[model samples]
Target chain A: MTAGPPSLTQDEVSSSPTRCRILATAERFFREIGYQKTTVADIAKTLGMSPANVYRFFDSKKSINEAVVERLIGEVETLISRVADRPGLSASERMREIILALHRDSIERITAHPRIHEMVEAGMTESWEVCSHHVERITAVLARVIAEGKAAGEFRVADPAHAAGCIQTAILRYCHPVLIVRCPGDVAPPIDGMIDFLLGGLRAG
Target chain B: MTAGPPSLTQDEVSSSPTRCRILATAERFFREIGYQKTTVADIAKTLGMSPANVYRFFDSKKSINEAVVERLIGEVETLISRVADRPGLSASERMREIILALHRDSIERITAHPRIHEMVEAGMTESWEVCSHHVERITAVLARVIAEGKAAGEFRVADPAHAAGCIQTAILRYCHPVLIVRCPGDVAPPIDGMIDFLLGGLRAG
Candidate 1:
């Protein structure tokens, strides 16, 4: 038997029209009604089909969510790849760009469908495996950048791995109020201070 | 109305024997079986009482968990107060010690109680009100320390509130692996190095 062609782009792979429509509808439905409250009937109704037709597409509500989460994971994977592909940039510059990109993208995307993000936070316990592997993969990309930075003498960290960990921690800590914990009234300081502090730490001074 | 009497020390306050027993059982059961798996009956059985007898003291599983979390918060409050009472240390020393203490205690008392901590993470949405208040109170405690340190000339930071916020972010970032994601059999990086990096960031230099 001949092996299938392996030249499919991700868009080609996930873009089977039926899967696309189902995912689009389900993501919207899940965002509006929430994961707990959304039903197969609602998804099917939104798609102008019977509830059983929705089942034919997904084994269960959980499976549809798994697909949605997998879709999210794929987007983050692309982010990791693009940063890894930037070979000409210094490690510090690359790392800075990646961190800023994640920050800006999270804020922008989180605004469009806040509940979708909340759904991920909600399912985190139950779906930790799905989410954390993607996070670890993201971390690994930064680790590569850190190692390259250290080798080039552009950064002066004793442990590339540990420094990478610290960078991720600092970014998340700064963003938690904005994204996760819902801090009140924009009461926090600007992110530039954190960026400066991190830059200073990374430098040999 | 007359102001209420000030409470005595934890040691001096006589906790009712039944309440203590219930709390002890709750913590132990939560640790062994986890929050969702552990039932009122399981706790009652451990205490050699009928499940019905347990409800006479607490209305539901939620109330018992609330008591456990309340006790944790109370311990944290007590720790901050004790630090406030210590008069001789320079304000910088006090602030550093506070940061270190929070890092230490959270890892020891809270992280050590795996199931309770797991429940707290899993039920963050369910208990957002309680968790937010707890975080804000802790934030205030750290903010006050920074304010005192700046006033006493032990800290030269231009912004106490921002410094305090950064301190909280640093500690939370330090504890991220323990709190947000489960780290798998990986040896922890030296907290000493991490703390030095943080202090460097916060330093007047």
Candidate 2:
């Protein structure tokens, strides 16, 4: 049979608007109550659907949480990608903005809903691949900026990918959700100072 | 009063051999059964003392945990200080050794008893001062090495204290007990590469 616009697979067909509604309701419950307390029945009740219907879309609450976490990661990745591709900004400026954005995003989320950390923690424990994917995507964005800087003679790093990993790891105190919420004492240096130190590393001969 | 030999105060008198035995037993319980499960009763039972007797030394399990955490911190600080004070090594070498010692210590503790993180988590939650003091002491040791490196013209950082903070913060993934235990995926760069990057920042103009 000639391909007339490849047919939607069974998975895609089942991934309907109902799935989006379930995730939206589940995310609200996770943010408001907590990941541990939010049950599949609670999500189903909130969405005006049966628990079986919710299960048709997501096999378990853990899977639903993974989807919610994926959505949140997508938002952050999009924000960073926009910063990375912004016009008229040098690589250093872009790098600084990207780090700040990550910090601000984390702080805003925690401030807005302190229990949001519970969801993220659950994601880290139960759905590590989702968390790991976010890290890899973020590192890729940083590596892209470093590669551009190296080509433009703005940085002197030997391995942009490794340097990007170093930068991401270095700023975990500022950006990681668990850290930002748990350690509010500003144990690390201010974000600007950290970015400066990382930039110095990139610029070193 | 005459300037005679000083008398031991009540606090000093009470901090006796019994106190040391209590702490030693509590540390073992924390390591084996985990912190939350090891109550004041368990500690008292292990040391063949009444709960009230244990309380005479430490008012609560939290205080005992604080003391245990303090002792653990002391060991790490002593290790790092020795690395910092080695006579023949350059400042960079000392810094590298210090960081490696920290990583090795954390890895060893976790590898030997994964439940040890429970005690640390309790310390972070219940005895933040003990934890904060440990951070300050570690930072102080790192700052001394950085300061010496700057004076010897082996590094070019402007503020050794701030640079030391940055270095400690940068290596958290490898050193922080919670992060090391929770995220075992090696998401960050290897420790040696991370140290080289931080050293590059220090040596940069």
Candidate 3:
């Protein structure tokens, strides 16, 4: 099938609306049929465009997946930054809110659209730079809050970066989409208690 | 092509030497050809036995993988228990050793034989119960140590089990075979500092 209308400019195909349409369509297919089963041709067919036109926006199928993941991570990163930038809260309090906010946002996204969860799982195994970049940005935000805490004499961390990394690692099962599913639940541990433990660990010596 | 010996009794197949032989052969093939590439038939061929005979011992390719994983996790469990059971060392000290031992052992195994790393990566995504069991056992060991510390007033954790879960998650990057390869390394955070951070957090409030 032809890409909608021949009158549509090449620039229009590369515009934000086109890009957004592609992602929305891809996400729907991913949810309905799963990431591995869904193909670029399928996405294009559903979008009523030729696969070649879809390529003009996303270089490869992998790029489309990466873009999808980037979009997901970007949303979380924005929420985290807002929590970090909130005024009047202590660094420890801010960090707690940031962590909780991250958990809430991720769980909500994955629950509403399970396909994004599958996309993340694939990204992790493939060693995608997008996933790594997402992790790096999150860790950086945590470290900044940590460094702020250290500056304010709220924490006695010798290395804010290291502490941030350790904290991220500690809360991974709660934060990581796959681990959240894999870790046992029959003997559920209180996440709030775990958070308190982590916060306690971060307290000034 | 054929069974090594029809006369080989069930008792003999279950014997330590036979089990060791099969594992060694499987590990060698896994390393050489990769986990997905190595088949039960291939393993049996290497052992001069029929795939049926191989199944007689391990039940399935998935079971064989589980045994291999169990063998790896068993080594770490032994080490963690030894550290926990050691007399005279404070609870915090035992925990430090346990975490360090886990980090060192996992990194060494993955580095020496990268193929097992791939096996683990696959196991995680495939939702292998054996992998989940391995994580559970490790977390249990950590919980026991935390409980001992709490009893001795070495830690102020309200919930030892929860603390253990969080600790395992926090150090997952250092402990998980695949994550060790994924997380950034130029700014390698010292595991000791993290142990200290965890210890400080667990200290009497």
The lowest-lDDT stretch of 10 consecutive residues in candidate 2 chain B is B1-10
DockQ, computed on Cα atoms, for candidate 1? 0.21
Off by over 4 Å in 1: A1-17, A48-57, A80-90, A174-181, A185-188, B1-100, B107-163, B173-197, B200-205
Q: How close is candidate 3 to the true structure, as a TM-score?
A: 0.80
DockQ winner: 2
Arrange candidates by DockQ, descending.
Answer: 2, 3, 1
Model 2: share of true interface contacts reproduced? 0.65
Candidate 2 CAPRI classification by DockQ: medium
Write down the TM-score of every candidate: 0.60, 0.94, 0.80
Which tens-of-lDDT digit does each residue in A1-205 have in candidate 1? 4343234455754566766788888888777767778888888887887766555566687778878877876886687669766878877788777877777767766667666655575446456666566667777787788788878887776777776666666677444422344433233346666665665556541
Q: What TM-score does model 1 achieve against the real structure?
A: 0.60
Reference-based lDDT, residue B12, model 2: 69
The best candidate in terms of lDDT: 2
Model 3 / residue B41 / CA error / Å = 1.7
Give candidate 3's error at residue B151 in angstroms.
Answer: 6.5
Error of 3 at A169 (Å): 2.2
Which candidate do you rate higher for lDDT, 2 or 3? 2
Ranking by lDDT: 2, 3, 1
